[model samples]
Structures are given as structure tokens and as C-alpha cells.
Target: MVALDGPSGTGKTTVARKLADRLSAGYLDTGAMYRMVTLAVLRAGIDPADAAAVAGLADGVDLEIGTSPQRPGFRLGGEDVSAEIRGPEVTKAVSPVSAVPHVRELLVARQRRIIAEVLGEVGGIVVEGRDIGTVVVPDSPLKVFLTASADVRAARRSSQDTAAGRQSTVADARESVERRDRLDSSRTASPLRAAEDAVPVDTSELSIDQVIVALCELASHRGLLAGCSAEAAR
Candidate 1:
């Protein structure tokens, strides 16, 4: 399996999706898993800090990522939650909930199972999240740890938040990005960092296409490219 780990606004989701499409491999968005769980915790009126309650809440919910030839989407308990999970409300609260050990354990277990399923069916998967490479699937053959300068990532976040109408000014989105960066990098449970075996890429000055090209090349080098007919490679 392939594991791409990185923090928010670093383009982990987009890059993983594109790489999966290119290789004809299944994709899993683990961040969506965390966001869905956080939404559940919030909707249930349970504090994220309550580890037992969060773990219990996770038990009663079924979280899985849906995949196809085009890309992957989020499904929580058989409901398509792709759109709802990306709202400003969920984004604002996901980090704290995601940092909790119970929440991470729940999501990581689900993530590993999904990866295993995809691997059994298709030989591998492209799974992206903060802890995918290091903690979720440490033995993955292809491990990528994506990164970008803080300012560039902040700009990306500002653009996304602006398009979503979550912020009026780029500055506001940048601030949100900074705050999230701190929380993600400092969290105790599977904090965002490169795994010892990861291939690090600084995308601060690179285009989306460039980043995907690098990841695709790296995957090919590692013999993780799927659906690569010999004649086609020739």
C-alpha cells in the first residue's frame, strides 16, 4: 500500500487522489474520516476531550471511504457525507477532536481496515492522512510525506476558505491555517511529521501538477504503480 501523510492545506488529499487515478489504484481520504467523526462528536454534544465518550461514540458509527475509478468520497454509516464533512464547522473542530487519542485510535483502526480491504482487492491503495505513513500503515512500500512552506500553505488555505465563503479576507484564512498548523504539529496523538522512510517533497513553490508528477514518479520507482500493462510502459 501507499501512504501519504501530511497536515491540512498541504494538498495531501488532492495529490493522493490524482496519484491514485493515474495508477488505477483505489484511494482513501483518511482526513474525511476524522472530519466525519468530529462532526459526530459535535452533533452528539459530547466534548472531544472525553476520551471514553468519544471512543464510545466511534463504536456506534460506521466510517468508510467510498472509491471508484474517478476518485473517492466519504461515507459515514452508509450516508454520503462528502459535502457535509467539509463545512467550516467541521473544519474548525476537527483538529482538536482528531488530536484526542480515542478519536485517532478509532479513525486509525478504520483506516487500516479500509487499506487492507483495498490492498486485498487491488493489490494496494493510496491512503492519505496525518498519520498514515508513520502510524496507520508503517510497512507501506510507498510512503510519501508532503510538505510546503507555511506561507504557501496558508495561501492555499486562504483561497479554499475564501471560495467556501468561510472567510472574507485572505488574511483571515491565513490565520486559521497558522492556528491549525500549530495544533496539528503539536498534537500528542500521531502528530504531523515525516516517517523515517517517507519521501519528502516541499511543494511550497511547486504547482499541483508538479507535485503529482513527483509523487507518481516516486510510486513508479517503488514498483507501486497499479494497472501498468507492460506494453503501455514500453
Candidate 2:
């Protein structure tokens, strides 16, 4: 398994997908899973701070996340909710829902099981999230912690929202990103910290392709891929 841990707007999801494709491995966006749980909590009219209630909801819901990079499906209770989980509502609610201790415990277990299943069936899997390296998969041989300047991340996020017609300003995006960083890092449950052995990549000045190449090199250096370093050089 490969663990890619990073905060929002750092291109964790995109990079994880590309890495999976490059390595011919399965991909899992743990963030999307959290978003789906947040969506369920909101739809059920449960308070975001109600940890016990949210945990119960998370435990009760059945999530099926696809590992295909080209067709990653996020389903909740057997319903396809890929688009719904990425909307503004779930975006705002996910931090608190993910902060809940029991919720993380339940989802982390599910994530581990999925990783094991994918490893058995597909040989490898790349899983991305804030706490994947530190909490979910500490033993993953290749753990990457991606980072970018706050300004760069905010601009990137604003551009994404613009493309999606979300009407977000750069200033607002910066605030949201900062807020999420604070919440994710301060949360008592599996807080967002890079594992001690994780390779850190500062992506503030790099393009998505460049970051992917760096990660590919790291994997190659660690002997995860036989010729990934040469492929990255090319």
C-alpha cells in the first residue's frame, strides 16, 4: 500500500489517482468517504458536533468506494453519491464529521480492510487522506506528505470552484482552506500529521505532473517499482 497524506487543495486526490494509474494500482480517496459520511449526517438533520450521533450514522451507513482511477464511484447506502458529496454543503460539514473520534475509528477500519482486500486482489493500492500515513496505514512502505503554500492552495482551490461553477472567491477559498487546516490538525482523532518516515514534497511551485513525478521517484527509490525512476526521468 502507498499512503498519500495531505491537506485539502494540495492535489492529494488528483495525485493519488495519477499515481494509481502510473503504478497500475487501486486508488482510494479517504476524503470522499468522509464527505459521504458528512452528507449523510447533514441529510439526517444531525448536528455536526454531536459526535455520538454522527458516529452512529457513520456506523449504520454502508459506503462502497470504487478503486478504479478512471471510474471512482462513491456510494452511500447503495446510492451513487459521487457528485453530491463534493458539493458546497458536504464540503462545509466534512471537517467536523471527520473530527469525530468514533467516526474516524469506524472509517479507518473500513479503509484498512479495503486496502487489504485490494492488495490481495490487485497487488497494490494508493490511499489518500489527511491521516492515511499517520493513522490509517503507518506501515505503508511509501508514505508521501504533500504540501503547498497557503496562497497557492487557495488559488488552486478557487480555480477548481470556478470551473465547477461554485462561485467561490480566492479570499473565501483561503479562509476555508485555513479553517480546514486548523480543524484537521487540531482534531484529537487521528489528526493530520505526516508520519515520521513519510517523504515530504513541497508542491507550492510545482505543477501536478511534477509532483506526480517526484512521488513516482520516491516510490522508485524505495523499490516499489522496478523502473519508475527512469520513467520519471523520461
Candidate 3:
């Protein structure tokens, strides 16, 4: 298994998907799972800061996540919410909702189950999130903690938002990213941090393709790319 953990705007989503594709493995975006719960909290009109209320809502929410690297899906109560979870409303509220301890407990259990299932079926899986290496899959064969400069991450986030039809400025994106970093790193439950054994890759000056190549090399070095061809693994 491969655990890709990092803060927002570091290209975790894109790199995880592409790396999974290259390795012919399943992919799980654990962040999207949290976003699904955050959306449910918003839809119920519950305050995200109200930990008890949000945890109660999360306990009963039916979340279904797809593991396909090519087309992973997020469903909330049988409705496809893949795109909706990426909106600004969810983005703004997700940090608080995800910080709740019970919510993390619930999702971490589900994530472990999904990871086991995918590993059994596909022989490998790439899981990405804020705490995957440190909390979700501590024994993963390969763990990567991706990082980038705040300015570069903010610019990437702005471009991503604009491309997705969301209006955002670099300044706004920087504030949002930094806010999330503070909240995620300071959260009491399974905080955002790199595991001691995780490989750190600074992506401030590297392209997405370069990051993927570096991870692929790491996986290969760890003997995790058993079936992949030499060219694809590198």
C-alpha cells in the first residue's frame, strides 16, 4: 500500500490519482470522505463548530466512496456529490467538521476497511489525505509527505478553483490554505503530520509529473512496484 499525506494545494489529489493509474492500483481520497460529511452537516443546517451536533450527523450519514483511480466517486445518501463537495461552502466548513474527534474515528475505521478491501482485490492501493501516513495507514509500504511553498500552493489553488468554475483570488486562496493548515495541524484528533518514516518531497519548484516520478521511484526502491513495468514505475 502507498500512503500519500499532505496539506491542501500540494497536488496530493492529482498525484495520487496519476500514481495509482501508473501502478494499476486503487485510489482513495480520504479528504473527499470528510468533505462528504461536511456537506451533510451543511445540508442539515447544523453548525460545523458544534462538535456534538456534527458527530451525531456524521454517525448516521450514508457515505459511499469509489476507489477507482480513473473515476473515483463520492456519494452521500445515494446521491452523487462528487462535484458539490469541492465547492467553497464545503471548503470553508470542512476543517471544523473534520476536526471533530468522533468524526475522525468513524471515517478512519471506514478508510481502513476500504483500504483492506482494495488491497485484497487489486494487490495495491494509493490512499491520500492529511493524516494517511501518520494515522490512517502507518504501516504502508511507501509513505510520501508532499510539501510546497505557501505562495506556490496558493497560486495552484487559485488556478484550480478558476478552472473548476469557482471564483477565487490568490490572496483568498492563500488565506484559505493557511487557515486549513493551522486547523489541521492543531486538531486534537489525528492531526496533520508526517510519519517518522515518510519520505518528504518538497514540491515548491517541481511539476506534478516530477512529484509523481519521485514517488514512483520511492515505491520502486521499497519493492512495492512488483508488477509495473520499469518505464511506468519510473
Candidate 4:
């Protein structure tokens, strides 16, 4: 398994999907699991700041996540909620839900099981999340901590909102990213941090293709690729 750990707006999701495609491996976005839980909490009218309530709700919610990079689907309570989980309310609530110790424990176990399934079926998998390397898969042979400057990340988020026909200023985006960073990094349970053995990749000045090429090269150097020529050349 390839563990890609990073904070929000760092392109972890996009980079992980492309890397999985290049390696012909399955992709797991653990963050989506947390987001699904957040959506469920909102629907149930639970207070996001109430750790006990959120943890209790998360314990019973049924979550299904697709490993295929080309068709990643997220379901909560047997309902397809891939798009719903990405809405503003869910995004706002995910940090608190993720902060709950029991919630993280529950989701981390589920993530590991999903990883095993992907490994058995595809022979390899790339998993991305805030704590994947540190807590979820610390033994992963290849651990990458993708990072970028706050300004760059905020700008990217603004661009994304614009593309989606939402008006978001860079200033607001920056504040949001910073606030999330503080919450995630300070959380007591499985905080956002790079593992000791992880290789930090700064993507502040890199393009999507550049980051992918670099990651492929790193994977090749670590002898994780079946054939570097065929995989990296793509």
C-alpha cells in the first residue's frame, strides 16, 4: 500500500487518483469516510461539536466506498451520497466529526479492511488521508506527505469553487484552510502530521502532471513498481 497523508486542499485526492491509475492500483480516500459520517450527522440533526453524540452516530452508520479510481462512489446508510458529502455543510462539519476519538477509531478500522480487499484484488493500493501514514498504515513501505503553501492551497480551492460555479474569494478560502489546519493539527486523536519515515513532497510550485511524475519516480526508486519503464512512461 502507498500511504499518502496530507492536510486539506493539498491535492491529495487528485494526486492519489492519478497515481493509482498510473500504478494500476486501487485508490481509497479515507477522508471521504469522515465526510460521509459528517453528512449522516447533519441529516440526523446531531450537534457537530458534541463528540459523544457524533461518535455514537458514527458507530451505527453504514458506509460503503468504492476503490476504483475511475469510479469512486461513497454511500452512507445504503444511500448514494457521493455528491452530498461534498456540500458546504458537510465540509464544515467534517473536522469536528473527525476530531472525535471513537469516530476516527471506527473509520480507521474500516479503512484497513477496505485496503486489504483492494490489495487482494488489485495487488496494490494508494490510500490518502490526514492520518493514513501515521495511524492507519504506518507500516506502508512507501509513505508520502504531500504539502503546499497555504496561499497556494487556498488559491487552488478558490479556483475549484469557481469551476463549480460557486463564488469564493481567496481570502475566505485562506481563512478556511488555516482554520482547518489548526483544528486538524491540534486534534488529540490521530492528528494531521507526517510520519517519521515519510518523504515530504512540496507541491507549491508543481503542476498536477509534475507531481504525478515525481511520485511515480519515487515509487519506482523504492522498487514498488512492477515495471518502471511501462508505468512511469505513462
Return the top candidate by lDDT: 3
lDDT tens digits, residue span 1-234, model 4: 789999888899999998898888999999999999999899999999999999888879998999999999998878999878877788778998999999998998999999998899889999999998899988999999999999999999888878877788999889888989999999999989999999999999999888888888788788887574456556
Query: What's the CA error at residue 53 for candidate 4, in Å?
Result: 0.8
TM-scores, each model vs. reference: 0.89, 0.97, 0.97, 0.97
What is the C-alpha local distance difference test score of candidate 4?
0.89
Write down the worst ten-residue block by lDDT for model 1.
225-234
List per-candidate RMSD values in Å.
2.8, 1.1, 1.3, 1.2
Error of 4 at 98 (Å): 0.3
- Which regions in candidate 4 have their CA more than 4 angstroms from the true location? 228-230
Local distance difference test values of all predictions, in order:
0.79, 0.89, 0.92, 0.89
The window of 10 residues in a row where model 4 has the poorest summed lDDT is 225-234
Ranking by lDDT: 3, 4, 2, 1
- Model 2 is weakest, by summed lDDT over 10 consecutive residues, at 225-234
TM-score, predicted candidate 2 vs. hidden true structure: 0.97
The C-alpha local distance difference test score for the whole of candidate 1 amounts to 0.79
The clash tally of candidate 4 reads 0
- Number of colliding residue pairs in each model: 0, 0, 0, 0
Question: Roughly what TM-score does model 1 have, to 2 decimal places?
Answer: 0.89
